[model samples]
Target: MPDAPPSAAPVEESTEDWRRRNVGRLLNEAVRRFESRVLERLAEQGFHGVRLAHVGVTRNLDVAGTRPTELAYRASMTKQAMGELIGQCVDLGLVRREPDPADGRAKIVRFTDQGLHFLEHFRRAVVAAQGEMGENLGEERVRALLETLWDYVHPDGT
Candidate 1:
């Protein structure tokens, strides 16, 4: 007899297996979970205005302050997008813009006292989140994961 035709239906992948095996998805889920914990803690501490979207710029911000262009570049965003986020931060009284000493036409964004307070809260929340992650994943695994991520992010130690 002649060979029958092949099946037309595509093979399906198990969602659980995919979730467990995809490195990008795993990393993204981990980040989401961590950010959720941090934001929840921030909310508990009365930092109600901060949102997940704000984190892209806020977390990348330099402690000594930086220009909008630089912040935008670091956050992998455009200057206009960074400017909008900065305006929101200004309205929230978290940051303020001052003329840059090195360049008269450019402005540097610096955290206000209120912003400093928020940063302290964020630091605490991050520590708490890390502790929780360690409790769930075990200390050694968590440390290894962090070290691996650090190496991935800074390949040449730069």
Candidate 2:
């Protein structure tokens, strides 16, 4: 006679359990949705040629300009990858490489006039996105969520 298989136990899915299981996935989906919305808004505002991959570099760009190495580190990408993105941005007239005043041998990436215009659109889109998120999540929950994300990103409070 064949042995009977053990019966599986029923598991109750509580809210906390569900959240624990899905938070990371939800976070990634939220980011993708937010980025898509922002890009859509930018396109409506007349910005073009900006891809999702470019955000990895642009989001970490320094307002005063920064060295490629520093930007790469900030973006957690290799220098070669950053260089390629910078080259693309340069070709798009979004950025330019200028000789670093502090180091003659080095170059710093600075935004072109067009890039600054694009940045303005990006800023407005982000603000609109945040407002939408607040409306959907409620102000208090959005605030708490921002605080939690900040703490998670800066665990040492630096």
Candidate 3:
């Protein structure tokens, strides 16, 4: 293969230049775009207006079937807000609250069979959306980038 001319070479960026460029802001914009794309695709797949926050709660429920208080802590949400959201999910038949064995005072929120089915559909939509993005950058690079961001976001452990 023939080497490219020097005039076409990649630009060398100084640390100071990169710092002044607001890279974090840029990354935040990229994330927003990614999220918008995913939501659009989900709608196209018949899940209109299904906010990503709902998926977060489902993901949390899957990992830890906990009381509302514990879920709020894990999800970094205010208890009142979590309760409201969980109530909405319950109304939608996306989740259920069962009496907590450890603490009868609190009910553990869990995914119902319907919620599990919806979660699976959500997973497929997310996977397809990510795969579409990965077509441009490759899946490995996207995965590594996400992992690196997670490391910074949850430095203490999530």
TM-scores for all predictions: 0.85, 0.83, 0.73
Candidate-wise lDDT, in order: 0.85, 0.83, 0.75
Model 2 misplaced stretches (Cα beyond 4 Å): 1-20
Error of 2 at 78 (Å): 0.9
In angstroms, the error of model 1 at 18 is: 4.8
Model 2 lDDT, residue 58, Cα: 73
TM-score of 2: 0.83
| Model 3 ranges off by over 4 Å | 1-21, 150-158
The TM-score obtained by model 1 is 0.85
Order the candidates by TM-score, highest first. 1, 2, 3
lDDT of candidate 2 over 18-63, digit per residue (tens): 5333556568988999999898888898767787767666777787
**Superposition error at 11 for model 3 (Å):** 15
- RMSD (Cα, Å) of model 3: 6.3
Best by TM-score: 1
Clash pairs of candidate 3? none
What C-alpha lDDT does candidate 3 achieve relative to the native structure? Answer: 0.75
Error of 3 at 106 (Å): 0.7
